[model samples]
Target: MMNKGRLYGVGVGPGDPELITLKALRLLRSCPVVAYQSADDKESIARGIVAEYLPGNQIEVQYHLPRALDPYAAQPIYDEVVIPIQEHLAAGRDVVVLCEGDPLFYGSFMYVFTRLSDHFETEVVPGVSSPMGCASALAVPLSYRNDVFSVLPAPLPAEVLEAQLLNADAAVIIKLRRHFTKVRDVLHKLGLASRARYIERGTMANQRVVSLDDMDPSQVPYFSMILVPSKSHL
Candidate 1:
């Protein structure tokens, strides 16, 4: 008879390897099986961060989960991607799933957890999230007394973006790479452009933190985020 296997959903922090939590590092070192999502690429930030911590010759699995443009076409992705990983856990192998930022926040690990937790003993190890890294890299306070903050993605409708920007004292907009120009225009229209600081690959080797006025959309990467704080509230 074999003991039941447990799953550890590990957050690797934003980009810096040193930011990984002690608990997360421990799991990576002890766990015999490791997994991380690539979506389409072979290399992943989450996987790279923990590679140093993992013991040599450990079984490592990388899932290239589909990122289909249409939700309807992605159902097969869910089935094919998660089923095999679940099987590995059921075989009594401790598995660690690597995620960038907090595992539960906008992370693909959530998808796996939701699918397999009913049968496995699952745990989540929190990491330093991206918003904190971005703010610290910019050397700015995220909020002042009584200031409300909103964190939203760039794909949100322009009208909604406008409303949130108008009301929130401080805001962090993620997923800004493709929508950089539009987001920039909205910030400028609301007279908050000067206060907006864009951080690209925050805390990473090629990290770039600059004012929105100086950024060119073409130069921004998908990992970029913009932090805008209202002057009136600050």
Candidate 2:
């Protein structure tokens, strides 16, 4: 029987190439096969972050997962990606899946990990998440002295988003593209709008950090996030 190869789910960090962990870089250089999620346009932010480390002649697998919010629509794409990955593992070739942030933190790597772990040896390497990167970019303390931090995905219904924002000590609203208007409305309703700061493409070269009040809401990008500190802390 041939030996099976291992699958490594590696987080390359939020955006900055310097943010990638040394372990992730090492694996990217050494892994025979590299997999990453790209858009229909074939652009991959995760791959761009670690592009410098990818060795020449390395096998690149680009999974063009949809950029939409519907997970149901993404299932078939995930299933398609699994086939090539399985083939690599069966052939005893180690595979490295590039993730934009911490693999399990709202990252598509979780889907791949769950699907492949039962059949293959898998490992995860952690990296700096977007919230951390955004906080650093804004020079704001995320949480301190028993402050509860909430990381909410903006796709949630307005009521749920409002309820969570009301309960949170410090909150980070992620995935703010199409949901930007709704999230901004929820923040305004909670009286937290004035306290919110928006960070777009955190840690990237063209990053933008501004007061949420100044933003148009509808004009924000998918990579944008909002940070709201607790009233007590303000």
Candidate 3:
């Protein structure tokens, strides 16, 4: 029997076509099977990014990852999610799974990769992450010389968030949608609200960037991200 085929976990970059790396674009164009995640719809942002590079009538697989408040409860959903792709890999078909931002950065690719590793060869191509793109879209530096950067989930407790802000030279808080108001309160309490900046939709066409003080949560989308650059260390 032929060896099980390799898997290409391609990062489609952060909401921009040109941002895709040469390596990722090349792989997508060459792969017979291209896969991506679809949430509540058949198409997705990540899929749109690589659409140009894909072959006509090529095999396109959509893996549906469960959208739940808790990642643990969603484990079973993901297991069921990758089964079709796994089946393709087992049949010796090289599959390219398109992911948003970087494959390893808070992405679904990691979940599938971890479970499918024993059965097939998997390669992850790093792409520009959302935070970096968010920073770039604002024309601001995420970190300066000797600056420390910490990435934390927005759902972190108020105290934990405060302590992290106190120590890091710079910090990025992701998943800012549900926790936006809480994160805003913590920043305000720590007197860091003025220094904070929010970017919604990152590098996408509808992206928005502004100082935290001026932001209205109602205007922010679920894809929103916030950055707090340390002014004290300057």
Q: Against the true structure, whose lDDT is highest? A: 2
Model 1 bad stretches (over 4 Å)? 230-234
For model 2, what is the error of residue 65's alpha carbon versus the real structure, in angstroms, after optimal superposition?
A: 2.5
Q: Sorted on TM-score, highest at the top, how do the candidates line up?
A: 2, 1, 3
Can you write out model 2's per-residue Cα lDDT over 1-234, one digit (the tens) per residue? 999989999999989999999999999999999999877675899999888777788998887656564778777777777788889998999999999989988888888888899999999999899999988988877888888889999989999998888788999999888898898888888778888888899999999877777788677888899988655654
C-alpha RMSD of each candidate structure in angstroms: 1.8, 1.8, 1.8
User: Candidate 1: lDDT of 32?
Assistant: 88
Which 10 successive residues of model 3 have the least lDDT summed? 225-234
- Clash count per candidate: 0, 0, 0
TM-score of each: 0.93, 0.93, 0.92
lDDT of each: 0.84, 0.88, 0.84
Query: TM-score of the candidate numbered 1?
Result: 0.93
Clashing pairs in 2: none
In candidate 2, position 1 carries an lDDT of: 95
